[model samples]
Target: MAPPVLVLCRLAPDTLAEFADRFRLLDFYASALPIHAFLAAVAADGDPPRVVLVFGGAPIRVGAELLDAVPSLRCIITISAGLNHIDLTECARRGVQVANAGGIYSADVADYAVGLLFDVLRHVSAGNRYVRRGLWTERGDFVPLGSRIGGKRVGIIGLGNIGSAVARRLEAFGCVVSYHSRRRKEDVPYAYFPSARELAASSDVLVVACALTAETRHIVDRGVLDALGERGVVVNVARGANVDEAELVRALADGRVAGAGLEVFENEPNMPPELMAMDNVVLTPHQAVFTPESMADMRRVVVANLEAFFAGEPLLTLVE
Candidate 1:
């Protein structure tokens, strides 16, 4: 019998096909039963799955409750760069190995971040709406001028793979880049601020590209937004919780911050209704890494990590 693997989230058909017959996949994601009940049923079957496959975007959490329900689980493979949904602490306590997509989606996410910034700075989406509504023809030269991307001081939060990529892309556009991370990177050429507020104070554009954790939750609060001033733009491609959505909404409303480009929200699929009415704000569903190339690359990385785990080799993207 092939090794049994528990699948906890929906996967793309191409990704599922990659598994083929190598493992007997227990389709927990397709089941209607609640997660706990599903795990109980799997446990009662006397063939507890040793490996669990998960996706990062889903709200499903692999924490103590889930871990306790499946004692036989030895490994978890997530097809996303962000591991905020998974409980690394509990997984470590149980000695369960966890692997993620690593930097596979970094370039794609960076591109999306820059695109969002450009849209906000240049009022691209708002202008498109104006043209489509025939307002431009009705009222000639009435549209407000937009800020230029060139020569903007762009400050990036968490200068990791995605942030670094954003910096590089923005540099090509003649934007000056600086950063604020947990620590200043010795190898990086950009100036580093010790805190987000300081970075915002010095920046014309602030980009949030950090992971979501207790320390980072609402990291971009009112102080940071106020420091960015009325002419500054904020772009967040990271987890929604990384920024205080309420504070952001208020900032935009009061003109404390000029505008924002958000791809994620504090609540999934639901955002503050006020943001929808703002012409200066640009919003998108969390799809920074949804490109065809990134999807294929994600599938490859996930399969390679699973293969390595089953082969008793070191995981290709171990989360440690």
Candidate 2:
């Protein structure tokens, strides 16, 4: 008989050993079949593994049939904090357990978010782009003007793990920090706003780090953008869904906001044409969690989820 199978859609090559060692110890998990092929394998095999350990870039339809086809699949674990890709409702209906890696690694992301803020505020990319294009000498002084980081009001959305981390970094620069979330956490020292609109209206810089949820999709619409005013800038390190893409393009194109820093887009891998044409925008390839340390830590959480499930123990980070 084949060893019991455990489905992991995709994992970094370096992360395989940790998972392999944990699974190798369990008789059923040791033989736990590995299926990296994705939905095709899920569809082809009628009987499913006892659990599915999802990672970055993992794609499963998670429709009614996804749970129906794998009756044996008792748990679904996603290694990332973002919930945009997973289907929570369907999983709940099927009584399948769910878990997500949350707060495992947020410091690096906070650093990157602040780096992008300073990168845009200081015109670091604009300066670099000019230098590389042979226009640095002519435009260096006036093209990308410098601004004082101190005494500026910084507004943050969704002050969770990553957001709190960002708040600390920004406060170190002597900026007055305010934020908006579903509710306030008594532990955080930052000022809290009742709504995002209020935060935007008063801020010099708006950093969006909210989760991608039904209520938060496109929370930063024209109203919020306009609230930030022409001198303000926006930085988004959260899901692309939180900001209105069309409105953002118009704002950047018309100089509504001073500038924008985008690390994630509404559509992954396909950035809008309007964004590419603008010079006031600094873009990143969804690499906020690309640091070697963050990746390893995230991988550990993923493997732990898998190992715990196979051992018939409690999951490390169950989302539902």
- Please report how far candidate 2 places residue 138 from its true position, in Å: 5.1
Kindly provide the TM-score of model 1 when superposed on the true structure, using C-alpha atoms: 0.97
Candidate 1 lDDT, tens digit per residue, 79-185? 87788889998899889999988999999999999999999988999999998999888987535789899999999999999999999999999999999999999
- In model 1, the runs with Cα more than 4 Å from the true position are 57-59
lDDT of each: 0.90, 0.78
* Model 2: number of backbone collisions: 4
Q: TM-scores of all models?
A: 0.97, 0.88
| Candidate 2: pairs in clash | 4-32, 5-32, 5-33, 99-319
**Best TM-score goes to which candidate?**
1
Worst 10 residues of 2 by lDDT: 24-33
TM-score of 2: 0.88
Cα lDDT over the full model 1: 0.90
